[model samples]
Target chain A: MQALVIVAHGSHLNPDSSAPTHAHADTIRSTGAFDEVKTGFWKEEPSLREVLRTVESEEVFVIPLFVSEGYFTEQVIPRELRLDGWDVSAWDSDGLSADTATLVAEDTGQTVHYCGPVGTHEAMTDVLVRRAETVTGDPEVGDGFGLAVVGHGTERNENSAKAIEYHAERVRAMDRFEEVQALYMDEEPEVDDVTEYFESEDVVVVPLFIADGFHTQEDIPEDMGLTDDYRTGYDVPSEVDGHRIWYAGAVGTEGLMADVILERAADAGADIESAIATVREATRKTEADGEPGKTDTDREPRETDTDGETQAAGD
Target chain B: MTDVQATAVDVRDEQVDALLKRLGSNDGPIEFDGLSAATDADGYALSTPESGDHRGLSEAEFRAAATEDGVAPYVTNWHYWEETVGHRGRHRRAFLRRAEAADERSVPARYVDLDSGMETEWGEVVVTATLGENGDRRYEIRHADDVGAAEDELDGYDDPLDARQIATDDDRGRYRPLKSAPTLISGWIFENLGGRDAVETLDVLYPASVANWNLEREDELDVTHWRETAERQTGIYDIIEDLPREAVEWVAEACCVDSQCLKRREWQYDEGDDLAADNGAGAFPCREPCSLVVAAARKWTKLEEEETHTYEFELTPSEKEQVEAIVDAVADGRIDEIREADVYEGANRYRTRFLRAKRFDEDGSLSGTPTDPTDEN
Candidate 1:
């Protein structure tokens, strides 16, 4: 049976960050989709290194529950899991890729699959749009006030801002509001400075964050100079310099977030069969080449195959 | 990196050695900030030498300063010695030793209790104590495990006894510390309670006790003894009610053992292991196998008392279609159909799966034979 491991960047200080992951695990377990659905954390107990030891599934699929693909996804997780390379194909009967099998002969004999971060999924836009509508109280984008997409921009990556801007454009194209603008917390046109740039009389500020943490409570409020509770349609009128501004909870906290994660997991599973086929083909190709010690290297290592099985090295 | 600027650097072996000697002779506590200011005026001065553009002072200069005086140049760097020596050095070492000691100690058992004066229904309690002049007098009650014992033991000694000598004839058989003559001293009880609202309640309790004790003060009576005894009695009463019955017995035995061990100023095997055994194995009731009983009770209580909301959201047409396809495939026992379901809309992509039902019997055998089986001759 396959095991589904949801890895989250849990917090020791805040109990809310892990809530959604736990909720998703509970929902999946209730349906009995997989033999086991466990949660591991980068910060909390049952860390990434110990995740495999805690479970007994023959095949394991790790889904990173992060909002973005960065250091944690690229370096930290790979290092912790002790994965050397990726394969776009399926594994041999020995349950190891040709190369990995030779590198570590005394293996655990279990197939491990790692799924990309859930944030990369397009279904997440639904979650964002829903959060935007909730903030504006408008079913359609053009029916109500302007929408503002708030993102955490850093000096290190320009692409991060581009991704948020792309999502904002999609929301704007729906014609759901009087206007839609992209704003950042760190980079140029900060949340406060950009609030005035909106042409609409009523502004709805939506935080594009995965967790309602320090940024949502302290930094955002301090920057916005807001003291009153802000929600959908409940505007906190700020008379500072004769401008009206309002705010809303983080987009990640929308009610249907768990649904989006479930959808992504299912999508990853759908591609597993093809991924397994690729692995088999790659293995056969390597064997036919007649190269001594040559390993299966044709297939690329993907998070999941078309059939939802993790592909082995060589497709 | 540029080559070590040869012209800008200078070597003055004699001047540096003299400065080192002067620094060593100075017995007063070294102050770096003050010395840095003094040396800043002259780039490489022993005592007020001419200013130069060279890197203020090198390691050799500082070393020379220390040796100038009789004191050994134990410190190679003057700035480092000034910052770390004397009171600051002592304090740093003390803090490190304390941390090391704490790490060596065993991890304490944590317990939750609601008896603390916090308004909340549940709060945590922690207790720690040290032995008195008598080695056996050491007794501690951790609120987590020994709440009951703490209360009962504390209550037993709450009364204010008179400073009376036991009659020699009556005390003949007993071995008492105050056997021949008796002396009296005042005793006070100090209790620390913690919780969400403990601070507020503590404020009220402390002030009221102080005022009440002061009001009762009178001539000819030892006010200190009276106040101490009264406070101890009240504290004992409070703890007695807060602890469980089992805790009471444990505390009594612990107190007796503590008193005996304390008098000798040496640890007894039995007394030392009593606390260890209580904490490690004997304190809490066995919770294995039967722990389900407690869990069920808790769940039932929560279900009856708690309120839950069944929140729902409207799925978009595409979302509905995707969910239906996956659900239908699972229900139809078409694992491949369900596994192939994928939804891609712009950058929003979703993968779905419908679970396959499990078969109970080995080799996929049927539980019951078919009712209508036709045989051909």
Candidate 2:
């Protein structure tokens, strides 16, 4: 059985930050398409190192549940999981030789597969559009309405801003609103700057963030000079100077995120038969040099190891 | 009783005579001028006999001062009253009486608009008062516009004492509740991470353990076991468990080995080196890794309980595709960035996908591996 572990950047402060990831993990696990579906966080309990230790699967796929391809996705998760030069030869079940195995190895062989962040999947565009529409009530390309896609952009990673730009471009292509633009909290063409970019008199500001925390509440409003009473009604315009702006809640608030996550899993390698076939082929090649009739591919009988010291079958 | 009465009467005559002389000399209208002169002279403005200030003076004296002497005479000759009461007494009394009747009565309320005053829906009002119940006493208040309007709306009572109480009560009611963000966040950390003691330990040791630095104290010759024990109890592991996953990841990235500030130590194996002889030499190299393990365990346990569950496995290819499409859209930032045409497309896609996934088998029979994912399960 295969296992997928979705790792998230949790918070020591805000429970809402980790809530969506946890919900998505539940959805994946409930489907029961894999042997295991777990979640791990960097800040909260179950530290990255502990997650590697606790993961029992011989072959576990790690998926970063982040919004961008930043430091955590690029450097931190890999380091924590010790993915460098790790080998999985001992855990291989199909009696395959080392040369025939497709598994990558390090000096100290530990087996693990690290996938790209779930945020990098193509399906996230739907979430952004849906959120924008729900907030602005105009999901079509036309005159009068404006869309501002706001992201938590930092100076640390230029690629992080790409997710926002990608979504903005897609939105602009649809031409549903009179205008669609991308903005950030940190980088240039900030949320305030994008306010001027919109062609329409009215704009809907949607935060492409996972939680309704400081950035969404304090920073965004501070930059925009929003008073406490602003954005009380969905249709009513939040007047800044003469321009009317409306705000939607953060993108993470959408309930359909669970579906999105499951869809990502399917897109990654969800076809059970295909995945099994691939593993089998790899196992067979590795086993070609071993004893002819002795294949380790068969599932072990339930009660063979009475001493509770069962050895893993080698491929 | 006779001795007490004689003393009270004498005090009342003396006070009334002085006040009458002050009022007789003042120039303004009787009500306004008398009070103003009395306030200007003695710093002891007179209210109706029912006022709290009335109780401060001898009853006989207050009665005589207000009735027999009358208010107008005091208004006319206010300086004489000031001479009798003392230099600052008149100003103090004026402010106190104004503060007392600010809600119910239209007394000339003394106020100072400060920069840090409150903000109200209506207009702002700033009030500062110096009280002299028996002698000279003072208190200051600066309210926001909303509070000022609220204060203005209060009903005026006939008695000054009742008016004072009413004003005080209104002021208290108008005070905004203290912002609870800090307390709420702290409490959340404490409750989630076991308790205050556990949280305190984590706060202390988190920097040292996560950053791989030794903590130094001013008093100790060397770091002792008790301090170590404290640090261990409050380790980064415990701190992480209290946090949500995203915060954990952010902090770890900011502080751990991958951080910009981290100093990487390269290992060189020499012949006959026992350190290099063991395959597990680098395992648990520092407290940082151990703390990380603890943090990961807590996070894992939490996620296991929150995420994994049983469901039936009966989804059509189309349904699965729809789900996959939605997921892809989210991952690629398409759904999150849907524009005019894409908005409808994204919504339709999400709706179909969500419905299909929500329609798992009624029996709750999951098709994947046998291991129960959730600890509760």
Candidate 3:
């Protein structure tokens, strides 16, 4: 049996940050695309190496649920997987691209197909479009609202900004927004400056992040003055200067990305029917993995000695 | 209640302009006049009742004199608004009554802009705007009666230098003005931090712990997220690995201060350094809250449930350097070169085990011997 493993940057403080990642994993698992689907994280347990070891299948797929091809993808995740390979000399000064699943597979010596980050996929724009519509209900209604696509752009790399700018352009092309602008928390053309681009009474700022982690949940909304009370991903509409700002869930957490996950898995030769349509057509948004019950780990066998003990996701 | 009773709403200085604009739209842009020094002083008191003899006492002065919370004096900015048409006492009483009748949230009150020229049920009104000590805007309500011996004689010291000197203490980190506001969660109260204690006192720990003045997230983010994010922002790695899991809770239960200045590892002269200087740097349970201490506390819960991999190596400093270089290369994507180049038996072995970073198998082999990779299975 083949397997699929997804890597996410989990949070110790906020349970909601990693909830979407686990939810999407469960969604893909239902499709039975691979022999098994496992989720690993930098912060939370079942660590990456643990995920690789515990998968019953020898052939596995490692998918990064990341926003862009940055440090975590290039350096941290590869190092964690031992993908740069065993021969110490084989690992050199220049690290591999984390998004390049092919290179990671070659170095790790595992029968794994590495997939591109979910954020870089053509299908993600659809997820973002849907996230905006969930808040405004219709594209025409969104036209009266300024769409501020907030991204975490680093001054060190321009690629991160390019990815966000790409989405803003695509969304703008659809003409659903009265005004479309790209803003960053770290870089210039900041989210604070987003208001300058709009004279509209209403603005819908959709955070283009992979999960409901730090930036999406707090920083973006606080900077934009979108809400006083912010949960992990979704927040109710807040009023500022008579302008209504509808805060949406992260684009990465959209169920459509699960199809993107399977597509990436399929591209990497996970023998399963490709459900690309699910990603394209997926509209139902969720703040939870399934329902508000005990986590899968709590019910499923709580990891054996061979595998690390599994705890619940929120913990 | 008498028409002379005073009230306050803890609002952010930035929001005050819009709030003022909203409250005084009927009076046009209010023409402000007040006594406050612009030099070495920064404060803003928006409005006060124009009825009394000493009506010019800034809101800061009133709060300073009345409260036991040790309120800070130097407010960078603030906003105050009072009635012009109706008697100040009756209007405030009516507003409070109306607010209590409708929504009972200490009223993030929305003032109706009664046109100055026209007389409504309330009465004829005039609203004036002025700049405060810190250059923050202030609005005054001056109605039909020209009370208090002309505008210049009372609180109307247009030039800050002309106003009577008011006493202000070392209140830099204190969010004093909003301490007495009926509403618990005001943007100004949360946004303007009086260290960690003030924020944490209201039981908003998550926001306080994660508050980063440098990142501009302090006003908004609670204590919950500070630790999860500290490692990245501070570039201080191994926060969990370096500190033991069991001790994280003890600090919070023990000598934990509200401001969290104690746990901050970003400063060279932090509480950790001042308290217990071990590990070439001390550990948690500092006098103030800091990112390091907070991160450790947050990490403790996960650490307890974690099934971590361990790798022990007693390598020389040079050997360790080589190992880091190799790991960096592997992490950097220079795998083929390292494989083709000189493979030091020690470095290779160390690389294999360390590459696992105490996160992989306990007895996993350094040598790639012919055995099933899924031997565990």
Candidate 4:
């Protein structure tokens, strides 16, 4: 059986942090691409340490639904997931090639392919560009709009700003937008002074974040002077300090993310065809049985050593 | 000793088929935990015992339905429960079995309720479990206040994470510092969550109540006594360790009691030195001094630094007892229970207001004696 595990940094304080991950998992599950689709959280239940244990699949693809490859992708996740032979120090030099790197559990023998964070994917450029144009209801955002790709930067990890910068450069290369700039919540050219970084009066700020929580909903908007009260709904193209700002939702919450996750798995050397085929076969067999739950698989009897020790489903 | 031992994976299908065979021959519908299975002329049916309603499936359908995604619910839920409450060198399997009422119940004797519908409480949240059409466990979490409220009358949430919002604040829109505080607002329900999702919902509502309860039941709870917990404090909290031994009991009485927090206080002055205050009667145990208690202790430590003073004040005997009663009422969170019409109740808002009006002077002093010598009043 093939399984997909989507890992995200869930919050103990804010429940919304894990919303996008669960949404994407539901979407992926509906497609029936894998035998099982489960979610793991760094902060919530079914934690990274135990998420793999829940899956009975032999072949598993684990994707990090993060906005960037940084301390989490480099260190915490590997340690928690117990990905054997992962050199934390080799992340930059070795590039941590997702396709070549296969994590096989010492005990479970589950062949796990750990994929890259979805944020750094090439498809994210499309998502960011799409968000910028759609939020303004202007396909011609390239004509006058200045795009600011915002990230929650930290002094702790230099790699945190790489994804935003990469997307900004990609958008700039497209030459669609008048100007594209990388902004951060904590670093210089911060989201607070977003208007200063753009020459165009029409500025579009897109948060390159996985979850639409406190930073995207409250702090960034408050800093941009778009909304005084975070509780009340704010409109797009809100007049902030005499500048027309169209603030899109977090990039991670995009519907296209479900497709991006599948792409990431494929790129990481996951046998997508085999996974899909397994699920399809089971579904087909169930359908052929003239009912949803019926299958034609043969059942072998018990081996009987300690058969009377405990009840079914017991330890 | 190279004995051939077949793994669970190798024997899962056989076990499921064996259980299905037994289910087919049952004299009538047999119920275990929340699951009910029986055979009829058409096929076999597995459903919730409480509802006793389900669409029957053929033998093939029953076997196929038992396993979701090539992983049997029995296996998945077994490993899930074992990892959840059985890890960390703890032994609450018996308690968990009893909680789900799976103890002494076997497959031939009865079918394993993989996702059994059970009702349990974690602090102020009432968790109700039921079975789905396919015999999957579904859970509904709501405030204890809305226990009997109709579904339409209360707001409904499908996402288990929505419990965070409901658990964050009280009915009055005030932030609750304690997640397990009795002030949880009502009128919201997280309906029809899966087994794992239900546990996650409960965790969001009350953090580690289930895990802590399991640890307590296993007698593996690690309780950090007052001195040990306090001595490790730094900065502003370091003063907590300087508090007199007797004052530690006051902190427990004020902060660790059942009326203040839901967790039963297991910590004491030290290992063997017990506090005079009552440890709470909560279903879960408090393993250590919580951050709230530590913060409160810091404030009390500062207050305890003040020297005692004697001031002369003329007050009637009944008035003195009324003053004490007012403090007691507020401390016990029973001020809302006192009605204005109950004039005789010392803590009644109107009665207290009248007392203040009569006793307080222009400077807001009690009976014209300054309420505090340090203050201008």
DockQ of all candidates, in order? Answer: 0.01, 0.02, 0.02, 0.03
Higher-scoring candidate on TM-score, 3 or 4: 4
Q: Arrange candidates by TM-score, highest first: which order? A: 4, 3, 2, 1
lDDT of 1 by residue, B211-305 (tens): 11212221211122111212222211212223333432343233222221111111112222222212111111111111111222223433445
Residue range B1-377, candidate 2, lDDT tens digits: 01111111112344456555554575432244225323343333465222223323343454454543223233222322244223332222322233334324321111111112211110112233232221122332222332333333533222211211222112223311111001101101111111112211221212122112111111211111212322333322333334444443443343233211222211111122212112221111132333333444445535545654564456667666766777767644455455544424533655644563576334443333234545223
Give, for candidate 1 chain A, the lowest lDDT window spanning 10 residues: A306-315
Question: How do the residues A287-311 of candidate 3 rate in per-residue lDDT, one tens digit apiece?
Answer: 2333322111111111111111111
Badly placed stretches (over 4 Å) of model 3 are A84-99, A103-109, A139-142, A228-235, A271-273, A279-315, B1-377
Q: Which of candidates 2 and 4 is the stronger one according to TM-score?
A: 4
What is every candidate's alpha-carbon RMSD to the true fold? 32.8, 33.1, 26.9, 15.1
lDDT of each: 0.39, 0.43, 0.45, 0.66
Q: Quote the positional error of residue B268 for candidate 1 in Å.
A: 34
Off by over 4 Å in 1: A86-109, A136-142, A228-246, A270-315, B1-377
Top lDDT hit: 4
Residue B306 CA error for candidate 1 (Å)? 54
Taking the tens digit of each residue's C-alpha lDDT, what string does model 4 give over B52-127?
3445787777766555332243432333343334432222233345435455543212223323345666677777
Q: Give model 4's TM-score versus the native structure.
A: 0.55
State, as a TM-score between 0 and 1, how close model 1 is to the true structure.
0.36
Tens-digit per-residue lDDT, A245-302, candidate 4: 8888687766567766877787766556544334323222123333333221121121
Q: Comparing 1 and 2 by lDDT, which wins?
A: 2
